[model samples]
Target: MVSTQLDAHEGSGQNSESEKPTHVETEHAAVTYQEKNAFQAHADESGEGQNTKMTKRRFMALVSQAFLWTGSQIPVYLFGGVPPYIYADIGGHDRWTWFVLANLLSLAAVCPFVGSLSDMFGRRYVALSGASFIVLGMIVCSTAHTMNVFIGGMVLAGVGAGINELTALAATSEMAPTAQRGKYVSILIFTIVPFCPSVLWAQLIAAHSTWRYIGLFCALWAFVGLVLTALFYFPPPRVNSEGLTRGEILKRIDFVGGFLSISGMILFMAGLQWGGYMYSWKSAHVLVPLILGAALVVLFVIWEGFFAPYPMFPRRINQAPRILTLTLIITFISGANFFSILMFWPTQAFNVYGHDPVQVGIRGIPVGFSIMAGACIVLWLLSVFRGANRSLMVISSILMTAGCGAMSVARPDNMSTLWGILVLAGLGIGGIVVPASIITTIICPDDLIATIAALTLSIRVIGGSIGYTIYYNVLVAKFTSAAIHYIGGAMVKYGNITSTEVIGEVIGLTSISLLDEIAEVPGIAGNEALYKIVIQAGQIAYAEAYKWVYYVSIAFGAVSVLASLFLGDIASYITFPKYQHDSQEFERWRGVRMSCEHSLAEIITENN
Candidate 1:
């Protein structure tokens, strides 16, 4: 039945006299074209057949893909604005809860399927659809007056972001010049390096007008991109004539893979997102979902390998792709430290540097600037080296280790002397992201490029989920231990634990209508002299938390170093690079020469 159906659809037949043939060929000419595609996968085992040439229009499509990739972060971070001003109708914590929920939800659910679908459909359709969803999501956020509506908005926004990634990095692998894929992917994402999601951007915008406009603004920007897809399209096409069909596309879509992968990721992310804020790390609410999520992910891998014909992470095409392997390990560690430092460092600023939340955000501008600078410097270095993928990775790991170690030295009472140290950490973090992306796009096969990109991203999200979870657990344990030790240190220095002056100075209780529980202790005189004991206690508590965060980052970098060492040699994995038969023979000969050299070297050395 399948063969008949395929044969019936085969050939360029305008065999019927009634129908007019528009092209230079018969009506069924397209049908023959489809047959070539349908069996193309089976015919070419070495992946060397002449497929199709890339054109200017496809390059434009690739460019559009990059835009979609970087734009994913906009909606994720834009929520930082609207939630602070959330009316009581939506709980003050409602915005944060929704923001975290939306991000985490996509990691597990929409993101997985979007990636699989991108593999099945083309990058353009999935990406544009995601953009449309993002636009509507933003509009919903703009007008959200109720909790249900707000939640609904977040889901839409997240779905768009999920699909956004499919186009960006994945499409880059497909559309970029064979030799230039790594450079372009890395350079393109660098556009967003300077655009950090500090609460300041949102706060500044909200000062003059309502915060809801932030959502409206994002929606408008996405709408513009949606329009630009047509204008930027070049005349010549870049479609590869690989074996892609509607049924094959549908089968590989892997609804089951999507469901399991996304659900597990979402549940795990939830465990981390709310771990410290809402419940203890060990609480059933946190641990159970994380456990279940892990198990589900295990099942997903099993299903992908043993059952799904066209797996999401097809082992055949990957065969230990270098960039992806390193990306998984490095991104895991980076993902953990990325937000943990930003979220916790403000406490150090408040207690150690004696700054309020506003001042804390203000003082961290150097970190943000350093982040942008680090990205540029890393790009320049990588560009200079000509495929120094492994070397760049080592430099990134070293910087991460150094930065995390320096941040561990931070004190709540005195950060003035070592502000530069904090900026160093930011530089390390920024350095990691772009290089990892460069590797991911270059080392993957053309047919499975999107799938690999999606999988790499999914793993990063998974690492992020687990990273936060582990950080929370460490934070609670260390905070407890440090609190006890800090109390002893304080009592030894001061004569009492909870003296009136100490408590009063330490807890700068706020009654502001907008931010009721904001703790903003001012001046060295008041907090230093009277609240010394209370301030000291908070310092001890925070140091403990920061200590584990530091150790975790160090461990992450250390393990990543080992992973980096094993990355094998970097090579451009262009699928059908100017697919000449002679070129194919040359590649085969090159492989044979490499194998013969290794075998001779082993024999010569052993005989000696």
Candidate 2:
């Protein structure tokens, strides 16, 4: 029955009798042309076949796919703009930090595995499962009353989100024509532009109601995506696989290697988070985890290289050309700088200017819009120049360094200046991230594009986790010192308080509303003069601390600039023909030669 249906569809007659081919020879020639074109599109361009026209069905499918990717991204943006009052509702001083850490860690850990799962099962099934997990995670987060429970829910949601993100990206790439992959990806990412206003919406909801409702909104978004996928998105059939039983395929998974990689990263990142905040840097709690985690990561690489029958890392492809590997490192620095700004810029506004959640969200608009503008700049650069990527990256790094340098001098009185500075930072981040992705796809083997994509996502998330941890610690340490020097005894002379310990307690429990609480102190209450003095002192201290973060951001940006110098000539990836089969074969042969030489050297030494 299936065979007959296939034959009927292939031989279906045209509406116009004159245009229809009556001869069997003509019909065979027509089918062959179509078949060859389809093969070239998928097999040559990393499975991103080109779509020349936008039919109604194709357009609907693109919208559905874009929504899924957008839904995955919304949670990160929401958390980045979360207000100070919302932290109190969650009942912890550092719960926001933990929440961010948990989310990034889960994303890093789950991304590589999700890519493999989709290939083994099917894209649609994997994506549906991800959405279901997100639904469950939202329910947990909405009902949670404790910080620990909330973080647990966020971790669960991160896993689902990671799966959906990669799946949606892969689907979008495959759905569009090869020439239009960038367009599809940009559309998917830009879906967030319309919803950037949701930051303000979340703030309003938090002010009038509770933060739990924000989680509910995200749950509903994921649910809608789930429905769309089930109805319209069908997974394409795989072209290559050897005959094997289901159990055999399951047994081939590199479970041990995957666990080692994920666990090592989680441990290392947790140590970075704990140091200088929860424990001293030299304490057993901090040192032991960091050391053990490093060891485990080394073991993971050793295992993947020698023991694992099916390794997680793409050893051969990673070494050829070396651009993919180099870009991953550059991406880590870029990711770090991007997240550090997004997470901390709002805190600076609220702490220094006494801005509320709504005000903070409004100030953040420039940064969000700047990111979209940066992506557009790349598109324009590609059209005008032959090998424009090197110049684009260098330009992005300069903007980032200049922007961060400018931010160090920002004062509450000169808050207007921040609008322009944020634009530069956003432009730098967006510019680097998008081009890195496109370059990776162009240089990578068609069969390994999904794996490489997952790897890049992991690198970025892990880098973000590291960046947040470092910047948060720097901010805390700097703030503590500055507050002690400027506000401790200085305030005691002016205020009713005899003890400086009272001021210490306030600084210890850091928040945007720190100064507002100083007025409520038992000894300092009802003295407007003393309250004003303390508030001024606090402002000066926060501004100094923020300067330290800006300085570090500038340093990271400089390093990214140095990395860009090494990324010579990507003109071939841009202008050359897709699927240079001879080039790929030569790379594989070179790898084989190198491996044999090393083995032969070892055998010769043993005999001697």
Candidate 3:
């Protein structure tokens, strides 16, 4: 690998949706004095002809993108199984609220700023800076003094995460051959596979040490990313075809859409996650924020669609595939279907499976492994059958819907059913990601790819965060209400029925873990005086909660099915938005790589 100083040259590169004008591009026709070097000079491997490949830069670039990719969604995904696994000591309900609130706040605040800064300066600088933020955030979180500080740390992590998250998608989409988009993104999608390691890390901390170890362990990953990026020399993909410069990107920036989107997502998550703990879902405190949040989202959509120039999601992209948007939404919603199960499954398994906390977590290993395996298989199949993207999406949705559907119908006694449904869910997730990537790749143009990728992730994170909060709130409420009803007020007045312990005894059992279990128990006093409310109330409440998880899945599944039907297939990308660089620079860069894959391909196939 070799580094080069700015040779004071010009060339063509692709333009992105975010670019404005550039200082150099503006003065191209006019003569120049000294060249302004906004970019730090770095070495790139040179090749004999057109076969140039920057091995060191590519390695570091992949390392950075892959590392950040691993951290993105898996942390939250593990929370599904983990929240239940840790909710007892850490205060499960409160944990969700703060986690979502903190992280969303970070994402909402950071993504646009990172995008804008990267838009103005460059992706490399933004990514490295973000990497530093992640490292700092991890240390802060590892040493968090209280819940608030933890939230603050997560906010910092989110900022770093936002930067890291966008790099691979944006970079890969721009660099990969058009025909290879699905496979390329799928390969990157495998980064989530590393997330399973986090589960082990989290479990180790939860069981052997403090949860702080989880955050502390993340510091290592972030540090590795930092080192890789700081040393890397990946050539920037052409994103400023129109010669957009730092000054212009800042000037035309739309701060409002970013603000409203972030604030709305944060408030909504906080309120929903707080339900039952901070305030009942129906109570004024929770209800007010939830309403306010919805209103803000509405305002954000209007503001972005009508007011903001270069909106995060421009209207043209929206116009292309309505169903694709729906698919993204449903994938997130159904992907999150296990929240209620995660909340209560361990408790249900306690007496039923006779497993302790550690054993229960071990039991969840299958579910975790299952999700990873499913995704790999889907990625493989899609790679083999490139045309199956749409079909694959439908299949993914169906799998998810079925899996969650089965879970919603499970009873405390039905351990087999519970495990089976979760496994199905794992398989469904495999199919979801590949198809979803294909959808995004096909529908959106290259210029908007980076912004859209960032937007998609944010939306999915918000959906998963809120979905769990809402699901858990309803499940917990119903179970609590049923427990109370089954205890019988008259018996309670007589000092007979007291806590869940007494309620458990009334049901001819030692414990009750789910709302539905209360219905199986015999009515108090054998239907004696004032017994009407207790017997039926338990049944009704349990039934209500049981309906939600399944019903929501079916609804989302139907929507996704429609979304799959509405997608449009776009063609290949070869000559990208020509960055303002002239033929000389293009030839120069190509000359550097002429000995790499490009030259090798031409030479090997020149006969054809």
lDDT of each: 0.53, 0.65, 0.52
Ranking by lDDT: 2, 1, 3
lDDT of 1 by residue, 1-608 (tens): 11221222233232211222111111100112222232122122122343434556555665565556555666655454334455432544422444545563664355445533543454456667877888898888788777668778878877787766544554443333323434545555554544454545554556557777778877876776665554563222212224445564465456787777777776766666556656777899889887988888899889988897655566644655565666678867765565555444543454445434456456655565666666557656654664676777777777877887667766665567557876777777667665564455445433343344455555555565566556655665566556555644564466454454533333322100122232243323333453455455666567656767778778877887777766654543322233236675556434323321221111100000
Model 2, range 1-608, lDDT digits (tens) per residue? Answer: 11221223335522111232211101100112122233233222122233466666566666776767766766666755664655666666664687788887887777766644654566678888888877777778788778788788788888888877776765665565544545655566667777655556666676678888878988898889888888877645422134333455466667898788888987887788789977999998899889888888999989988898777655644633567766777778778877777778767876787657678668777776776677567645644574676788788878877887789987768888788888888888877776665555446543354455566667777787898888888888898888887677556778646665777765554434545667777666788887777776777888989899889888888888887877766565434233236687444333322322221111110000
lDDT of 3 at 349: 40
RMSD of each: 10.9, 11.1, 10.1
* Regions of candidate 3 where Cα sits further than 4 Å from its true position: 1-61, 73-95, 112-114, 169-188, 191-194, 197-200, 233-241, 274-283, 319-321, 335-358, 376-390, 409-414, 485-548, 562-608
Among the numbered candidates, top TM-score falls to 2
Ranking by TM-score: 2, 3, 1
